[model samples]
Target: MWVTSSTDKVLTPSAIALGNFDGIHRGHQKVLQPILQASAVIGCPASARKVIRDSQCPYATVVTFNPHPQEFFTGQSKQLLTPLPEKVKLLEQLGVEQLVLLPFDRELAALSPQQFVEEILMRQLQATRISVGEDFRFGHKRAGTAEDLRAIAAKFGVEVVITSLQTCQGNESEQPTLRISSSAIRQALAEGDIDRANRMLGRAYTLMGTVVKGQQLGKTIGFPTANLQLPPTKLLPRYGVYCVKVFLEGEGENIITQSSIKGVMNIGCRPTVAGNTPTVEVHLLDWAGNLYGKTLTASLEKFLRPEQKFPSIDALKAQIAFDCDLARKILERST
Candidate 1:
């Protein structure tokens, strides 16, 4: 998708979906569908025949905030379900033609409801139609509501579509209904419920980062690992060993495909080895190569065990061997 700032001039009108869309979870899909449906009727560029017949068709744009408004206002560091680049990829896969990542600062946050609709939506984006979740609010401490959006947008000849919140049945009998949201997915991941988080996300929970050098303790014990330095704001599953698939970052024509290798990943401080900080270390099964200075995307499949402090290095090594064998079997079954 063509990405631009909210202040950029729009040459063509757009049918836009607006939200934080941090995780782009199933509920976000409901908010986005109206824009896609409108795009199809308006003739997006991808369908050449339709575009040829309707030259004035509006582009499908997703307008999202960066750093999340909560993080911006509170200045608190928190893990996000999906980072900006990953969110962009997800939106593109959903057939969005353009993305407008608006910077959330004090100035933008100070705009009144009417000013936001007139200045950003109508004047800048040229939005012919706008879609948002029923709970969506904006402008000056969220003074604007979905009802406010409709009234203000109409003055600019813009159409407003509000999507109802989506929910899924709870897995446990105690809780019957659960709203699908980014916070819910984060809670699942923080609790190490990978399956539930994946179900909510519509995909596996993934971590992407550049490989960095570590203490080389894994190599000394016969299982060499590539340590990953992840973004500080990226949310992590509970500290544990997990079944994962690894994809090496590629250059030009040598792009590596996802799930090209199966492995066991440890996400924690190596307590048994007297390590102090949490780290992501992965050992590729039956594979060896130089991975320093390369990026890798690790997709978590299942949680195996929590990080522990073994009595001895030999005992830790033996436990790792068992973890590897278990991970191999799990990966095999998943395939």
Candidate 2:
């Protein structure tokens, strides 16, 4: 989909969806939709279809930043609901023709609202239309507003579309409408509310990582697991055991498996073993294989239980067995 962090070169005339888009949740999707419709993207992202020169045919583009503006400004490492790589894939799936991961650094952050629109939107991106949610803020010291965007873009004959915040129901139809947002999804995950978070995400939340060596404690206990080494910036759900759908992937995220394998994943420190640092490990149900050095994407399907220290290895093993059984039931029924 032509993902670039280039500050140089003007691309084709584009309709850009601008946001942090951490989780690419439903609300973010709303901002992206009008651009897709307005531009009339000619073909799939995989095809790299060039935009037609006619004034009405602008390619769909998404301009977001890395390290998150909040993280950059606060100097605090923040966990992301969808890391940059995952966010790119999701945007491509939504048929974005281009993705500008504008390097969010001191220089870029220093630009005033006027300079941002002139240099970023009008010059480099050549944006014919710009889309953002109502709450979007931009430029130095967060000085830009949706109205400001409209006023500036209008000066260059660029169209600005502001989308309203989207609210949605929880997994259960009877539940009250909940505001769709990255923070809300993070809160849901923190509260162990997987279903509500997934409902807001419009799909199962996935954790992508490479399988690395662990203490071999699970192996010794007969529940050998592939320990996942996830991105430091990735937001993990509450430390607990979960029913997961596991997929083996090749580099660049091409799926290697014919179908998802059901699994039980544990994301926590093993207090019973005197472990202190948090870790993620998954035991693929009814499967036997070495996943060392391979990449795996595990989708959280159901929350099994909160993590707690057990009395002994036997106790932990017994509980894992039950968790595995329950995961199989959930996976089978969902299938």
lDDT of 1 by residue, 1-335 (tens): 77876466443577889998888888888888887877776434466723352325677788888757998988996678778777777888898888888888988999999999998888888888899998999999899999899999998777899988887767773267677888888888888888788877777888888999999999999999999988887888899999998888866444465646999999999999888999999999988778888888888999998889999988998999999999999999988
lDDT for model 2, on a 0 to 1 scale? 0.87
Index of the highest-lDDT prediction: 2
Q: Candidates' TM-scores?
A: 0.91, 0.91
Number of backbone collisions per candidate: 0, 0
lDDT by residue for model 2 over 1-335, one digit each (tens)? Answer: 77778857435678899998889888998999988986664443333345235455777888888768888889999999888778877888898878888889999999999999999889888888899999999999999999999999999988899999898875555457888889989999998889989989988999999999999899998999999998888999999999999999764444477599999999999898999999999999888876888889999999999999999889988999999999999999999
Reference-based lDDT, residue 116, model 2: 97
Model 2 segments beyond 4 Å from truth?
Answer: 41-56, 171-175, 251-255
Q: What is the lDDT of residue 272 in candidate 2?
A: 87
Candidate 2 lDDT for residue 97: 73
